[model samples]
Target: MTSASVPAAFPRAVLFDLLTALLDSWTSWNHAAGSEQAGRAWRAAYLRLTYGCGQYIAYEQLVRDAAAEVGLPESAVRSLEADWLNLTPWRGALDALRALEPHCKLAVVTNCSTRLGTQAARLFPIRWDAIVTAEEAGVYKPNARPYRLALEKLGVQANEAAFVAGSSYDMFGTAAVGLRTYWHNHVGLPLVAGAPPPEFEAPTLDSLLPWLGRFGLRPQTI
Candidate 1:
């Protein structure tokens, strides 16, 4: 959709996907694994396991399992898991979050377990309105349950919230539940087949700031 086609008012709340959207966890995995290919494989393996199980698994355990699947040593797996404790924010992620915080409610709805989600939040200080993990919802993204739960927690209708996702898979899930989606397409990946396209797209978290004006958002004085 064109920028002018965007709604004139911002959603009452903003839901964010935690892993890649807010934190640079993939880069940490790549550094620990010593190759980008291996890091991608590990993430793929982790998603396969998470979806295959149809339930929440702690991200650290998922990391260990992915390490095993990718034939990484125990030491490397440990390092990868430890990296979650101090995940680096994507460039301009914190600034973007800070800018948006006062304008609307902000929440994180992630595929991670509650422990990992909490740890990630501590690493980056934002007063989130809600933090919903798959573990709490008893299901993962693309399932509809977690997204619905997030909407419930935020006390907003689907149309009254916007979901910002780092992956097309997540965009599909968020859109399926009828929330406006903004895809953070840092890698220039094509949209996933069989899923609806996101309502908005940007190369980085900071790129979304200027576009918020289309939603009629203004900085609020706390």
Candidate 2:
């Protein structure tokens, strides 16, 4: 391809947070909790546990621990596990992804076990260029490994890529790894205190493609 046809307006690769940014794991968590109130609290606890632990830990254990911390029973954990496959894609997520696919390589950097992470990723119809899980990286997000692992797999430097973060906590890791992030704040969660802000923030993935248009020289399919 000639320089004039290169996809210069967009990064060469875009990495996404699987759980929050691409899929709606929240509904399944709430369903497992038997109420939205219980589900939200439990989910929050889980995030706290994952973000603080730094190194790898059994992801399911964290879920159970978080449930108990929020007064949920063991059954909630079971329910969540059983219903894990039911996690839905956020509205417009697929469309936005399809739009970017021709112009950029796509991948996911999620905080999940290899089993569940692979399963959750299969829910999407597209073939990912890379799928980096906490299990695979031996560390969770906000730690540099997972994000860097994805970048390594994509064969791109951090500056050559962008991250679509589902949670504000991702800002810390992505920044440390030198990847510009676009916070897909679909749930309206607050930014974590002391974390860097994302390059862009939106309630839905619809804005992702448009925001990406502002970068690089001119976009052509990669």
Candidate 3:
């Protein structure tokens, strides 16, 4: 893509899952738990709680509860909050976002509180068209509200945009709202049983541009 070029308009917007898709949030959790095993357990518990709870629950409270469910101490929760800013982007996240920046609208529909979602989204340095948090939507995903809220803010229908999902659990939400999804399955987690499959899945974002190209994301003349 060059300055004389622009993206085709079919996919007018690209929505992302900020925490897991864009950032290496797993590392932060691992550090907070003092071990990868404990972190995985705690994070998995957190996912189940959020996705199954349906309605809104304080995001931080869910985190603390997840820690306890996994037999982790309150100190783990303290460490997670204290080291939140230490979260970094996944490899190639910056490049992928930068490539898409001038091409189409970019937004985030993350399952987090507004404060934490805003902070995590800022790590990108890209001007997001919108950032819809679970708190704002009054429900955690795999509920459809957060994704629908983001689509509304972007002013595009579900078919006119694509969702980048970090967790397979997102398959339920995106499908419910009729949004096509591309799973950035960087962690190699298995798909959720009975969940809809994404249009594409990869260990990294390297294929995102090419995949978008298939949907008329080519460059346009000035």
Candidate 4:
């Protein structure tokens, strides 16, 4: 099948949540700064389970189990969760993404091993057109399964769906699938040093709108 045609104004469905959208990099999770030590001594024991068991484990469950694993009671562990749980959207991101909510169907697609895309649904309000997580797709970003599932879930054509990915890999992924792609360009990752380029480049997530407008959008009829 050919790409779904772009509407005159904008895509009726737009997916937005990336790790860059929901959480900042340089945060401890990626750092693993003592995840092992923290997993053993910290309040959440379950945090280590994803490593030992399946990747789809819940952070909350990890938090709960980590507490028990580290010998802290669940109540005590709950007290320190605010400091331990640091995943949240970047600064100014909410307002920036907000500008588009009124204009189109906003969705979130994530490569997280868990339901991180949906978990983000609570922190930011986009009134999503759809939400898809890697666990459901059985593969990570750059893989066709997740992208395919996301398009199916969004009910939009490949061309109509502009994939906004923070990393080069995700950009390469969606573009390969024939969907328009936006490299959110947060960390200045090179474009795979000669890989096929993304359709658009955004210095920051805030900068993607004008570029996305090129694709056009339609009023969310539903």
Expressed as tens digits, the lDDT of each residue in 1-222 for candidate 3 is 222255444378899998999999999999999999999999999999999998899999999999999999999999998988889999888998888887779999999999999998997888999999999999999999999999899898998888999999999999999987889999899999999999789999887776765555433222
**Which candidate gets the maximum lDDT versus the true structure?**
2
Q: Give the TM-score (vs. native) of candidate 2.
A: 0.93
Per-residue lDDT tens digits for candidate 2, residues 118-159, read 999999899899999999999988899998889889999998
Residues 1-222 of candidate 4: C-alpha lDDT, one tens digit per residue: 112464335555566546664456335332342344453245123323432343344445655565566565556445434443456677667775687677666666775535445665556655666777767765556666677787887777777777777666665567667867767766565675445687667566655665555565332221
Expressed as tens digits, the lDDT of each residue in 1-222 for candidate 1 is 115655445568888888878888888888788899988888778776775666666666877887899898778787776777768888888888888787778889988878877778777777888999988998888778888998998898887788888878886677679887888888677776777888778878765665554544443111
Q: What's the count of clashing pairs in each model shown?
A: 0, 4, 0, 15
By TM-score: ranked, best first? 2, 3, 1, 4
Better of 3 and 4 by TM-score: 3
| Candidate 3 clash pair list | none
Worst 10 residues of 2 by lDDT: 213-222
Candidate number with the higher TM-score (1 or 2): 2
Model 1: residues >4 Å from true position, as ranges?
Answer: 1-8, 216-222
- Pitting candidate 1 against candidate 2, the one with the higher lDDT is 2
Candidates in order have lDDT scores of 0.78, 0.89, 0.88, 0.58
Model 2, CA-based lDDT: 0.89
What are the RMSD figures for all models against the true structure? 4.7, 3.8, 3.6, 8.5
For all predicted structures, in order, the TM-scores are: 0.87, 0.93, 0.93, 0.66
Q: How do all the candidates rank in terms of lDDT, highest first?
A: 2, 3, 1, 4
